[model samples]
Target: MHSLPPLAALKAFFVACHAGSYTAAARELYITHGAVSRHIQVVEKWFGVNLFIKQGQRRVPTPYALTLARELGGAFDTLSDIALRYGNGGRNNVFNVSVPTTLSLKWLLPRLDDFYARFPDANLQISTANTEQLHIIGHYDLLIRRETSGTEYSAIPFLQDHHCLMASPALLKRHAIERPIDIFSCPRIETLTRPGQWNLWLKAAGLDKSAGNGIRRYDHFHVSLHAMLEGIGVGLGPINTLSQEISRGNLQPLFAKITVAPNQYYALTPVGVQKTLLHRAFEDWLVSQGQRDIKLADLPL
Candidate 1:
């Protein structure tokens, strides 16, 4: 038996705690910051416990509050699941999906028009935070991420972000490059922000050195890709990540034979658990789209 907290207050509390900022929580909840603050205080007064410690502008959760918060979050997720399953007639399918920026922009958004056109009733909420921050298994209804664990979901292999040595043709043509060892000893090496990506790629590609010197890092893929596109330096990027550019003649691969990176883009489906029709439809449609793209990408490499 659960003693129900005030629905509004609990909602506010969950958002505030999850977000770690009342103002941010208010924006997500579509209410004013004062309302969120009032709701939390109301809950605190009702329970005779302090849930938040105000340190200047930040709200720190007390130990009790943190435990309560986890419970509250679990409760909300359960209620959300119930609402998604039974609140409407196969519609009201608001599915929350967690995805990486690389897939979100390049792949998912481009194919989403069909989904919207077919199932206009389904509403989708996409969380754009990197997979490193959000638990793909914990909260989201679906996650399209680089396949790390493989057992995370229904297990669609989808597309491989194959690691490759790519650079602008001008850079390659100017420098004589025959062996993998040639990449290092260059002036600058452009690489992505992922942890150990550059070093690991170099090592996996059978390069001479693992770390130390000849490495320039960029926080975003676009920045690194742009540097490579402008003929600045060599970039070790995914095969699929460079496919579009290669087609457009903006970039070229150094080696024809590629390695499906130790990492890959993956799609996870939350099926079997009852959900909104929109969610199910979107999941099915996404898989269908992935199937369709495989045919489109049968380009001669």
Candidate 2:
């Protein structure tokens, strides 16, 4: 017979690795902190080694523990995917989709009602993560990500994205940006996730990349967009996603002729996977909506 630690202990340890602390894991697992500690202790004893050790005020997983956690994460994810795909729930129109965080917040989430109205029976389980996280996350019927050079999945074009300089009306007024060069006088807001965006926009506008007065970096595009809306700085705004904000005069797109960094969002699925009716319906709907958006915005294909 195979010897194994208690299932509860393994679960506690797994959650603790990702949660970053025992207390956080306890909170997530709905167990007392002492109970979580006890569970982890059981796993440690079963393995004949310490999985976590105190480092300053935090408990850090050992290297061996980190490796174990990675394997366990994949195993648990596979199990979850299998259950979701083959269980009775799978017979329904339930579909799991992973999307980028900012795109989901600013774009897809707003348009989901339309999808629901069109197909009342379709149930979408949406998860948001960055492009990097999508690689580590579990199985999904579909994923929305920017078109990258070497993606392994089959990609279908979902949306068009073009970047242009944009800032709040008040901020633009304060900065007196009469020309592309004048933007350097304003603080340049950037996202840590897409550090090359500012450079790409600047280069497309025929300006030096290093000419900005100051750089402020946020961890995500949504945060940077919010900062720009607050008149903290100027940022590269995604034309299609922020169209409403521009139309309402909340923000102003500058340099009408200098739009750059044309990228497309793609609906991706693992290569060679069977496509179900749910997948076909959602994909068709997404493409139709994306096309309609471009047509209504009077943007080029």
Candidate 3:
């Protein structure tokens, strides 16, 4: 323990490397920028290495420093998780979750009231982001997103996401979309987040990719779904997530048999961390909700 560098300096260096700037690190640590720099200098001196180099009015981490940062990140996350687990005598009911944007809006939000009704004592902090950050394990207790690669974490499949062409009743009436070829005449809406979606659907339907007139691009599925509901165009929609809209007759699925199963939604938890009772409760509830929604959606499977 006597040979160990100062814990504060190591923590500061770890944070500064990730934050990209000493000022940002200072803000996060509630310390002055100079304090952060001094802490980093202490770490550099203890380690006998140059961790950062100035480049065009900004400091960039050296390759060796980035390697150290990765190691420190995992160590810190493990320490934090351990602290969180026993810090309150295992009474921490505050669960943090990260979810993709469109899914949060279309599916999760609608079902949250029921969750609160069941677990009134549960404190849920939900964040919606398009990208998963490296610090997700440290910041969030769970992540709900499309299937991700890698076996580093435990990913439990919850919901099935199969996309099909859909449009409002009014748009369907005007387009005369009886045959697959008739769909080319109507406006096509594309979700920018799900690239190559239109092509995938077209290929599945045995139609040429260039069949549609033109496409209006939206960043997320919820936005494109809204455009479809307004009769702006016909777009691909996930059946299970859009169960409410489909059941209410706001949007009608076209050629339901031509749907494509791209991927499924998953609830991921960091490996090695002990799951609290709250974690198990929420995950079980989510799985149950997904099963019920799939049946309600009446998907062709």
Candidate 4:
């Protein structure tokens, strides 16, 4: 057998390289910064090379270290794939799904019981992360994300998300917002990630896009939606994410007469695994449930 550094040391090295600091690596690995540094030192001693250099309180990987990291990352990915393929016997029934945090909390979690009820025997694991980072589809049986036209995976359109103005009934009553233009008179809740959303909605509504002011920006859509729900202000709500609240009268739609092009929600699965029974069943159920929740004609137009 070839002499190799300890797996922990290798892991620490990889995390350090990826995270760019011992402290960050430690946080990710659930160890102390000192431990991460020692692990890196161990790996460096085994390899007889300086893997990183201090640059303004950050550990920057050397060119050779970067090359090594790339190779090691690929190796780890391959090993993980192999382990996932054969580690669980044919009886393995676990289905792993990754979804965006907002979508998970606002949409999926509410209906997860139905899924569990239908597939009680199937082990289900749901993880939430940024949707943009889900393109890799690693270690997940399925991903729910905004539809991309890429051919990397087989995508099933689940929900057509249209942006609309939404607010609590109390907020509307307080502001006396009888028309779309009246929304600018109240506090406008916006998300940092989608700053242009209000402009898009305004332009679609045939109003001056630059008219709104006093915008309060939050880092996440869920937080912004919560602010609107608590009667803080009006927010640009994606129909798919706020449909249940609107249906329940917690949020009132500002203008249901105008509609804009929609960003679609898609259920993505790796091409090779699409034929699996669990994958197919989950996809079918998700699509069916999504259709039942919002019909095409029901979409604002």
- The whole-model lDDT of each prediction reads 0.68, 0.82, 0.82, 0.80
Consecutive 10-residue window with the lowest summed lDDT within model 3: 292-301
Colliding residue pairs in candidate 4: none
Residue lDDT tens for model 3, 171-216: 9888888877777898899888779878888898889996557778
Candidate 2 lDDT score relative to the true structure: 0.82
For candidate 4, give the lDDT of residue 175. Answer: 93
Per-model RMSD to reference: 6.5, 6.1, 5.6, 6.4
Where is the poorest 10-residue window by lDDT in model 1? Answer: 292-301
Residues 123-233, candidate 4, lDDT per residue (tens digit)?
A: 777888854665553577788888655776788887777777888988977998887788889999988877687777888878997786888889988789889999999
Error of 3 at 74 (Å): 14
Ranking by TM-score: 4, 2, 3, 1
Q: Per-residue lDDT tens digits of candidate 1, residues 93-200?
A: 567788777667656776678787887766788777544543543467777766545444565656655566777888877877676677764545554465566655
Better of 1 and 2 by lDDT: 2
lDDT of 1 at 183: 70
lDDT of 4 at 146: 86
The segments of candidate 1 whose C-alpha lies over 4 angstroms from its true place after superposition are: 8-46, 50-90, 114-122, 132-138, 148-152, 169-207, 210-213, 219-223, 226-231, 258-264, 275-301
